[model samples]
Target: MDIRIGIKDSAREIAFDSAQSPKEVEEAVVAALDSGHLTLDDAKGRRYIVPSAGIAYVEIGSESTRKIGFVA
Candidate 1:
């Protein structure tokens, strides 16, 4: 899954890839917002934590495959 996190006052949003389902990610974001902290684990086992209060939005979408070479 592809996830993008918008932070308050930040020009660029945080983007990452995760193995978690959309529902799971939404639940985690809600839980973090309620608890004032957000934690996420990526597909590579890397973890990320941020302040929930600073989160502007959370975007979750399906991953897209990158195409190489030219198509006719």
Candidate 2:
């Protein structure tokens, strides 16, 4: 299984093959925000503002690559 992370402004991508849970993904996002690498806004105490400036993707198992599409 390969997971790829893409950025809209750059052609290079970051790929990882380790398995991670959904919670791990969330934790990573939070860590990125805290580190000032990612911008996240809070709304209604439970909502988060996801930046759409860059493109991200993840591949699970042997299926085709999936884009990380999120609603604003």
Stretches of model 1 off by over 4 angstroms after superposition: 63-72
Residue 63, candidate 1: C-alpha displacement in angstroms: 5.1
Which predicted model would earn the best lDDT? 1
Residue by residue across 1-72, what tens digits does model 1's lDDT show?
A: 899999999999988999998899989998997898999998899998989988999999976778899989
State in Å the error of residue 65, model 1: 6.6
Model 1 poorest ten-residue lDDT run: 58-67
Candidate 1 lands at a TM-score of 0.83
The 0-to-1 C-alpha lDDT of every candidate, in the order given, reads: 0.91, 0.48
Model 2 C-alpha lDDT per residue in residues 26-48, reported as the tens digit of each score: 56565665564543222223323
Candidate 1 at 37: error in angstroms?
A: 0.6
Whose TM-score is greatest here? Answer: 1
What is the model-wide C-alpha lDDT for candidate 1? 0.91
Q: Counting only residues 3 or more apart in sequence or on different chains, how many pairs clash (N, Cα, C under 3 Å) in candidate 1?
A: 0
